[model samples]
Target chain A: MSHDLDWIAADWGSTRLRLWAMAADGTRLAERSSQPERAPRTPAEFETILRALAGDWLERTGTIVACGMLGAREGWVEVPYRPVPCAVTPAALTRAPVAAADTRPTLSLHVVSGLSQATPPDVMRGEETQIAGFLAKNDGWDGVICLPGTHTKWAHVSAGEVVSFQTFMTGELFALLSEQSVLRHGVAEAGWDADAFADALSDTISRPEKLAGKLFALRGGHLLDDLDPATARARLSGLLIGAELAAAKPYWLGQNMALIGSDTVAHPYAEGLAAQGVTVLRADADDMTLAGLRAAHAQLAGA
Target chain B: MSHDLDWIAADWGSTRLRLWAMAADGTRLAERSSQPERAPRTPAEFETILRALAGDWLERTGTIVACGMLGAREGWVEVPYRPVPCAVTPAALTRAPVAAADTRPTLSLHVVSGLSQATPPDVMRGEETQIAGFLAKNDGWDGVICLPGTHTKWAHVSAGEVVSFQTFMTGELFALLSEQSVLRHGVAEAGWDADAFADALSDTISRPEKLAGKLFALRGGHLLDDLDPATARARLSGLLIGAELAAAKPYWLGQNMALIGSDTVAHPYAEGLAAQGVTVLRADADDMTLAGLRAAHAQLAGA
Candidate 1:
C-alpha cells in the first residue's frame, strides 16, 4: 500500500489472523487484523482470509513470513515440525499452495515450522517463532524461555538451540475448571483475589499431589461455606499454575529464565517463579511474535 | 402394586430416578426406573417423575425413603447437611413437601441429609448413602470406602460414622480430558490398553505433578508416533486416576479399603490400589445404595 512497504509478517492462529506491514528497513509501517465469524474450513479459505486482512499490503511482489497454527496439519499447509535439539528457525520455510487467482505470483507466502520434542513427546506451533524472536534479541542467552498462554511452554535453550521443551495445559485447565467443571458453580468469570491466589499456589506447589483432590472444595466451599466466587476463581488459577511450576522446576531452577508474555497471562508465571527465588526477564508477547516473524522474513529476503 | 410392597426405596439423581418397591420383610418386591428427557425443574416435577416411575407402587399409605441429588437445594428440597464426626443417619429425616394430591397423606417422603466436612470444606449428596450401606454390612469397619464415579469419594469410615473424606475430580477429569480437551483428537471412546494404563498410573503416582505436562503428549504421541487411540484413552484414564490415588494415599495406605461400583468404573481404582499393595474389598454400588436406604427405612418403621 505504501512505497516503503517491503514484506508482510503474519501470525495466523486458529481463530484470528494478524498482519504487520513492514518497511525494507524492518520497521512496522502499518498493521491490520481479522477475526472471521467462523474458522477457515479449507486451505484456499486461508488464502482468502489472509488477502482480506492484508490486501493493499499485498500490492508488491514481496514475501510473507507467517507462524502459528497456519503451519498445523489442518492449516493452509502442513509444515514439518523441526525437532528440538536444533535451531529455533528452520533452514527452510514451507511455501503455501498458491491459488489460481493469485494476482502477484512472486508475492510468495512462507510459514515457519513448529518445534517438537521426542523423548517426552511435545509440540508447539505459534510459540516457536516467539522463542526464536526472544533468542534473536538476546543473542547467546542460554537459559529457559517461557511462553505462557493457553498451552504454556518451557524451553531449555543453550548454544542458541532449543535443547528440549515441555508444554503444560495450565491455562487451558484453568479455563475448563473455572468455566466447565463443577468449580464453575463457584468461580467468577473475571475477578481478582490476590491473597487467595498466592496461598493456593504455595499450598499446591509444596504438596502437588493434592491438586486433584482440592478441586472439588471450590464447589463445596461455595455450597457449604458460601466461599467468595472471586477467591474461588483465583484459587482455581493458582492450583493449575502451581502444578505446572512444580513440574517445570527442573527447567527454571538455578537457570536464567525469560518469560515472553504481557501482564495478562505472564504475571502469574513471573510471580510464581519469583516466589521460588528466580527473577524472570520479560518481553511483550505481541512484540515477540512480530519479532519472530521479522526474523523469519529476513531469512527469506536474504535468500 | 403387590400386597407385599410395604415401603419404597428411591435413589433420585440428576438424570435418572430409581425406585425399589419393598416388602415389610425388607425384600425388594419390584423395581422401576426413568431417565427423564430433561432434568426435573420444579419440586412438583420431581414428585411427578417419581409417580410416573412408581405410580402403581404408590397405592398404599406407606413411606418413600430416598437419597441423592433429590436432597440437593435444587432438588425436591434442601436437606441440611449433617456435619462430619456424626452418625451416618440422623435420628430424624427431612420430609419432602406434600403436594395437593389427596391420595395418601400417610404415604410420606423422607429424604436423607448429606454429610459435610468443615476443615477442607467437603460435602457429599448421594455417596453418603453408599458409605452408610457399606458400614452397615461391615459393622465397626474402620477403614476407607472408595466410591468411584463422576466425582469419586474417598471417605474415612470409623465408629459407624464418616470421620473425614475427600472428593476428587478424577473420573470427571478423565471424561473432560479424553472427550473435550485437545487429547480428544487422539483418544478413543471405548477402547482398552491395559499396559498403557498401568505404566501411566505408575509414572504419575510417583510424580503426580507431571500430570499437566504429560497430557499434551497424548496428542503429540498420536500425531508424531502413530500412538494408538485406545492406548491414548487408557493413558488419559490412568493419569487422572493416578494423580487421585497419590493424593488419596493417606486414605488407603495401610487401611482396609472397600471399592463400591461395577467393573466399568471401579476396576481402575481397584487396580490402582492393588498396585500400591492394598487389597480392595469390592461391593456392587446398587446394592450398597439399597442397603443404606433400607437401614434408614428400618429406623422409620421401628419409630
Candidate 2:
C-alpha cells in the first residue's frame, strides 16, 4: 500500500521493539515488531535496530518519538527521570543525540524520560507514557491509575501530575512461584476459577501476612484435598493481587481509580477491586502508548 | 579410628543424605553425607542409596532411624503424617518394610513421620525431627519454636507435643528474589547492614501489605540514590522476615520462643525477634537432629 508516513511512535523495551507509523494528523499508518537479540548496548546499536524495524516507514526528516527502557541509562541514551508531582507531557520528553555515523539521517529520535520519586525511591519507564495517554484522554483525572504487568504499578495522579506511586513485583512473583517454585507442581499453565480467586483475594486482603503460608497451602491443598489446578492457579493470582490491594489500600481507598493496561492483565485488578466494592474504569495499554507517543510527537512538531 | 556402631540416625532430604552413627548409649560415632544423583524414585532405590552410604557401618544387626523426606510419599517409604498435638518420639516413628531381596538382613530401617496440620494444611519433614529433638531436651516446656530454613516453621508446643504450627517460605523467597528476580541486580550475595535490617523489619511488620512495593524499592533505591548492595540484601532479608513475624504474631507474641537452626540462619531471626523485645533461645539444628534421633532410638528399644 502506498503511504506517506509522518513520524514514528515506538515503545522499545528490554526484550522487544514495537514501532507504529503515524500520519501528520496522529493517525497510525502501520505497525511492526522485532525481537532484538538483546538490549541494544549502545546508541549506535539502537539506531541500527530501530532502522531495521522501521526503515521502510521512515520519511526524510521524520520525527521518531520513543518511550520505555530505551530511555533507561542502559538504553539508547540515558534520559534523566523527571521527578514526580510533574505532568508527563510531550514538552517533558528528552531528545537523544544521534550517532556521528551517517545512518538514518532522516530520523530524529526523541525518548520520553521516565518518572521518579525521591521519598521511598520508586521509578517507572514506559508506564509513564501510558499514564500520559490516559491523562491526555481524561484531561482531569485526579485519582489512582493502576498499570498491572510484570512489575505492577499503583500510581496516584492529581492535578495532571503523578503525586506518588508504588510498584509491586506481584506479577513477577506470581509467574516465578507458579512456574518455578514448588507450587508449580499443583498450578496449571492456564486456568480460571473465579470463586477461588475471590475467596483468596478476600482471605489475603484481610490478612496479607498469611501470604507465604497461603502460597505453600496452594501446593498442600492440592496434595491433601485434591484442590484442582485451575482453582490453585486462580487462588495464587488472587492471593498476590489481594496482597497488592491490601498494601496499596492507601492509593485506591476512597479514590476514583482507573486501570490502564492490557485487558488480560488489567481484568484481574478490576475484579479484585470490584470485589472490595470499588469500581474502576479501564483503558487499553497499547492505545494509551500510541496516544502518549502521538502527544509527544505533537509537542516536538510544535517546538 | 575403629568404631563400634550401635545404630544409625539419618535425615534424608530430597537432595542430600545425612547419616549419623550412634553407640548403644546414643553417642554419635561418626557422620557422613552424599548428594544422591537424584531423588530416590522408589523403595528399592532408597534402599540402594541407603546401603551405599552406610554399608560399612552396619553390624550383625542394626537399627536405622531416619527422618525428613525419607518418609514422604516419594521417599523411601510413604509413611502417613502423624497429626499434630502428639509427642514426636521413637514410638511415633514408622518402620519401612524390608525388601525381600537378601542384600543386608542386618539392617532394619525406620523413618519418622512428619507432622501435619489439617486446618492450615501445612507439612514439614525435617523440622519435625528437630522439634522432637528440642522437646526431648526440654520436656514439659510449652511455647513456640521457630525453625528457620528453606521453609521457616513456627510451632506451638505444649506438654511435650506440637499443638499447631505454620510454615513460611521466607528463606526460599529470599533466595529466589535475591538470586533470580530483578531485585538480584541490586542485592549483593554477602555482607549485611544491621541498622538497615532492623529498620526494614520494623517497617514491614507495621505494614506488610507494603512488602511488594518495599521489595521493588530496593532496586529503585539503588538506581535512584545508590543504595549499597550489602544494605539492600540485608533490607530484603529483614523485609521478608518482618512480614513473617507479623503473620506469625499469634505464635510468637507473649510466648517463649526458641530458634532451632544453624547459627548463620537462626541469628537473623534471633536479632529480629530481639528487636521486638522478645528474647529467644538458640539450639543448634544438627545437635537437635541427633538428639531427636537418639530419643527415637531409645523409644525403639523400649518398644
Candidate 3:
C-alpha cells in the first residue's frame, strides 16, 4: 500500500494543513491532515511535521510539492511572489532552500510561489494553484475567474497566463459583521430568504455608498418591522456581496466568468451575477485545488 | 442649591440616563445620572428611574423635558416620530402619560419625539434634539448640521426647521471593522497618523466602491510593507469616513456645515471635510444635547 504512493501534495494554510499522497501519474492514493499547535517556524520543523504525516507512505525517495501560506514570508521557507502576467503552472514554482542536513534522504520538498500584481499591489498564494488547476482544464481560456472565500479573489486569465487580479474582503466582512457587530443581534444564525437577498443585492449594487447607512437599517428594520432574522441574514449577505460586485464590475463586466468556491459560498455570487444578466460557471473549490496541485506536480516532474 | 432648580432637562438613552437641574430660564444648576440594568418597559418605570436620578432637584412640582431613546417605541412610552420639514422643538414633543398615582406630585415629565423621514424610511431618536440645540444657537442658519457618532446624522436646517437629513453608520463600521474584523489583527488599538488618514480618506472618497477591497489591503500592507499599526488604524478610519463623505456629497457640497460630536469623534469628520475645502464649525456633543433639551423645555414651558 505504501509503495503505491509516489509523491506528496500539500496545501498548508495559516490555520490548517491538508496533505495528499499522490501516485507518480498524478493519481491521489490517500489523504491526511494535521492541526499544528502553530505553523512551522523553520524548514526543519516543517520537515518534521511532513515526515510525521506522510512518513509511512514515503517507502522510497519522493517529491513533495506544497502551496498556500507555506510560501508566505512567515512560512517554512520564504518564497518570493512571482509578478503576474505569467502562467499558473509549476514552471513558476520557486524552490525553498532544502535542509542541508536532512536525516530523511527519502524526501524532497518544493514549495510553489504565489502571484502578485505590482500595479494594484495584490497577492495570492493557494488560490494561484487553484487558478492553475482551472486553467489546466480550460486550456487557453481568456476571461475572469472569481474564487470566493475568506478573501475572495478575481483573476484575469488571458492567453494561458494570469494577467491581473483583485481581491475583496467580502466573506470576512460578512462573518465579522454577522457575528460581532450590532447586526449580530438581528441576523439569524441559519436560514435563507431569496427575495430579500435579491432585493438587497440590487439595492447595494445600485447605491454601494449607502452601505454604511443600510447596515444599521438591518437592525432598525428588525426592531421596527419585525424582520425575520433569516431574511436579515440573507439581506446582509447580499449587501456585502453586492458591494463587492459593484467594485469588481471592472472584472466581470462583459467577460466570460467562472466561480471557484464551495457550492454554498459561490451560489450567491452566481445568483447575483445572473440577476445582472451575466452567466457564471460554478466549479468546486476542493477539486480545483487538487487539480492545481496535480498540474504543479506534472510541471515539476517534466522539468 | 436644589431650590434654585426649576425644571429637569433629561437625555435618557438606551444605556444611561443624564439629567440636568435647570432654572426656569434654562440655567443648568446641577447634573446627575443613572445606569439602569435594563431600559424602562413602562411609563411608571421611567418615572421611578427619573425620580431616583433627580428627585432631589424637584423641591416643588416642576416639569421635566426628556429626549433621546427614552422616547423610542421600546422606551418609557411610544412617542410617535414627527415627520421631517418641521421644527425640532417641544411643539413636536409628545407627552408620556404621567403616573396618576405618583406619591411625589413634584415631577411632571415630557419626552421629545424623534424625527423620521418617510421617503427613505429612516428614524433618529437622539440626534434630532442635538439638531434642535444647533439651530437654537445658529438661528436662521440654512445648511447642514453633522452629528457624528455611532450613527452619524447629517441634517439640513432652514428657517428653524429641519428640512431633510441622512444618517451614516460610519462611526459604527469603523469601530466594528477595526475591533472585530481580520483588519483587527493589523490595526492599532490606539494611535493616529494624520497623513495616512488623509491619503486613505481621499482614496476611498474617489473610489468608494473599492471599500471592500481596500479594507483587505490594510492587513496586506501591514504584512508586506511593515505598515505601522497607528497608520493602519488611521487609514482604516479615513477609509470608512471617506466612503461616508462620498455618499453624503449631496448634503455637504456647497453648504456651510457644523459638526456636533465629542472632540475625538468629530475631529476626523472635520478634518475630512476640511480636506474637501469645506470649513466646518465644531461643537461639543454633550453641550448640544443639553442645549437641544433646554430648547425643548423652553418650548414646553411656553406651551
Instruction: Encode model 2's per-residue lDDT on A58-124: one tens digit a residue.
Output: 6443578999998887788889999888887653788788756555465678988899999889999
DockQ for model 1 equals: 0.79
Instruction: List model 2 lDDT by residue over B107-201, tens digit each.
Output: 68888888888877778888888888888888777799999988889999888878988888898889889998988989999999999999999
* Models, CA RMSD each: 2.3, 2.7, 4.8
Q: Encode model 3's per-residue lDDT on B224-255: one tens digit a residue.
A: 67779999999999999999999899899999
TM-score of each: 0.95, 0.93, 0.82
- Report the first chain's TM-score for all candidates: 0.95, 0.95, 0.92
lDDT of each: 0.85, 0.86, 0.83
Model 3 CA deviation exceeding 4 Å by range: A1-9, A12-24, A29-65, A70-79, A91-110, A298-303, B1-25, B29-65, B70-80, B91-110, B299-303
Runs of candidate 2 with Cα error greater than 4 angstroms are A1-3, A35-52, A58-63, A98-107, B1-3, B36-52, B58-63, B97-107
Model 1, A172-230: lDDT tens digits are 78877777887788899988798898888898888899899889999889998899999
> How many clashes (backbone N, Cα, C below 3 Å) per candidate?
0, 0, 0
Q: For all the predictions, what are the DockQ values?
A: 0.79, 0.68, 0.45
**Which of 2 and 3 is ahead in TM-score?**
2
**Which clashing pairs does model 3 show?**
none
- Find the candidate with the highest DockQ and give its number: 1
Task: Find the candidate with the highest lDDT and give its number.
Answer: 2
For residues B123-233, write the lDDT of model 1, one tens digit per residue.
888888888788778887888999999899989988887899999988778878777777788999988898999999998999999888889888789879989999999
